[model samples]
Target: MAKTIQCTVVTPERKALDQTVDFVVLPLYDGEIGIAPDHAPLIGRLGYGEMRLRRGAEVSRFYVDGGFVQVVGNHITVLTAQAVPADDIDREAAQQQLDAARGQPASTDEQRQIRDRTVAQARGRLRVARQAHP
Candidate 1:
């Protein structure tokens, strides 16, 4: 049998997931990172992308926005601003959001930042949805 580690994903609104999995892949601020049982203890800032968890032959996926991740003692905790399961994502709606974000005019730096973040999130959602469907 494959080894497993506890993984918990939380958002401001609610707890997204809590389970034991054979492996986990997170979207770090710099890039993607994979974790498994006995992984080195560490902390990292998360980026907007898909977070995938695997257990045996089953794979679970979530679109995660900005957050932080911590790993210690065979446990991984993810605290994100937002998270949506791949099955729950609406590709058309996500595409609309991406288009809106792209078309919106950013008058200020803050507005630009927000717009960029929104675009990234919508893109992530679309990517995850496509992967789920295909």
Candidate 2:
């Protein structure tokens, strides 16, 4: 049998996941990184993308806006600024948000920041849903 490690994903609103998995693949600020059982302890900053968990034949995915990840022993903990399980995302709503954000006229720096965040959120949602169902 394959060995697994504990993985917990938390966002400001709630703890989205707490499970055991053979490995985890996360989108770090720099790039994608994989974590496995007994992985060396480390910490990393995450970016907008999908977190993929693999255990046996089952695989799950989630979207994270940005966060930090800590790995120690046989456990990985993710503290995210924002996160959503793929199943919880509404594709139509995400698309609408993306469209609305894009349609807004360029203005102040605050508007740019909002646009950027909205785009990132939409991308993360798309990434998670694609990976989860594909």
Question: What TM-score, over all chains together, does every model reach?
Answer: 0.94, 0.85
Candidate 2 — which residues are off by over 4 angstroms?
Answer: none
User: What number of clashing residue pairs does each candidate have, in the order they appear?
Assistant: 0, 0
Displacement of residue 38 (Cα, Å) in model 2 is 2.0
lDDT of 1 by residue, 1-134 (tens): 66689999999998889999999999998899999899999999998889999998899999998799999988999999888898988888888988998987789999999888888887888888888777
- Candidate 2 lDDT, tens digit per residue, 42-97? 99999888888998888787888888999989989999987677888777777777
Minimum summed lDDT over a 10-residue window in model 1 is located at 125-134
Per TM-score, the best of the predicted structures is 1
TM-score of 1: 0.94
lDDT of each: 0.90, 0.84
Q: Highest lDDT, which number?
A: 1
